[model samples]
Target: MLLQTAPAPGAWERLLAVLKEWDFAVFLKINTVWTGAFGDFLMPILRDQRTWYPLYAFLFIYVIYKFRWKALPFIIIAGLTVVLTDQVSSTFFKNYFGRVRPCNEEALRGMARLLLDRCPSSGSFTSSHAVNHFGLATFIYITLKPYFGKWGLLFFFWAAFICYAQVYVGVHYPGDVSCGAVLGVLLGGFTAWIFKKYFNFGNRKRGDLTTASPTV
Candidate 1:
């Protein structure tokens, strides 16, 4: 029998390995040290999309009620924003990186606490939840800011909250969510700019939604 020795990693590869270790350390800190009974119960709920069905419905209804026919294009663009973010993050980034979820890692079987019933088989470089939510948040903030003022900022906090819950629930690393957020923001902002440029929804002064608005 012949024994073969593998080549050692180069500096760049070694650096990436070190970064990965640091990411795992951060994941462990969030998953283990920052946990509690209340978090264990609430994070899963917060991170779950099912929990926000009512909010989604309300937003759909509210946009139509406020903007009438003009809401159609906004809705379409918003939906596309989420789809783009989800696909780019989940399909492209995940497949490219192929990083394992902490919960799904055999090495972390005893260490990582998985709050969900089953851990997904997808790769974990960029969190789809973070991408989707942050994309939507960015779209909402930019498109609706003229009407909602500073309240639009709340959308970002909402996105961050869900991303934090994702880490707390043990599915994604902090780096995954952080990069997802940046990508989401870029995509969402681009879509919003497109909508504003072509669709031309009434850009009333900040917080002034009472005036008769122009339709797209």
Candidate 2:
């Protein structure tokens, strides 16, 4: 008798294929259909690393000034979070999936609008920009929420805007950003939990917060 494959596996494959089609359709909607002059001008700027250098510098100094030596551990962990997410998304997921970017996709040869002068030659899935920003956003939101309260929520929006820019510029699909966001959140949350449990800055209230050693 011939061996038979399970029907569930076939169904799962069909479901994945349908989801991929939807992902592509949504990507086109964002990248091509839903667009504006202001967005076209601003998105590339929003996604540019150089644009955020001042902000990054400010945050680095602010944290050290705010927490003194205690901020050192937090800084190290935050840096590690970005490094981990970038490697996982760019090195692992992108290589494993090997999906071509919309700008490079043969199917979108004439349909896609590529804003960049030249598209990146890397794989498309799980955008590293999305992963890194979301990871940092989640880490910042979690670690600093106690001090910043509702204002910390803006970090998520900041990350999301960067992710949108990635799709708008035709470098990544919606699914890529979505999955990257989820993965980033997971890794960030885990690191945050570790920091809180072990390398906690202090237990002092936000108002009464003062210098404290990095200890549990």
The C-alpha local distance difference test score for the whole of candidate 2 amounts to 0.85
Q: How many backbone clashes does candidate 1 have?
A: 0
Identify the leading candidate in terms of lDDT.
1
lDDT of 2 by residue, 93-191 (tens): 999999999899998899888888889999988888888888888888888766666898888898899999989988889998999999999888888
**Whole-model Cα lDDT per candidate?**
0.89, 0.85
Question: Tens-digit lDDT track for model 1 on 118-141?
Answer: 899999989999889989999988
Q: Using TM-score as the measure, which candidate wins?
A: 1
Question: CA shift at 162, candidate 2, in angstroms?
Answer: 0.4
Model 2 stretches with alpha carbons more than 4 Å out: 1-9, 204-216
Error of 2 at 80 (Å): 0.9
**CA-RMSD of model 1:** 2.7
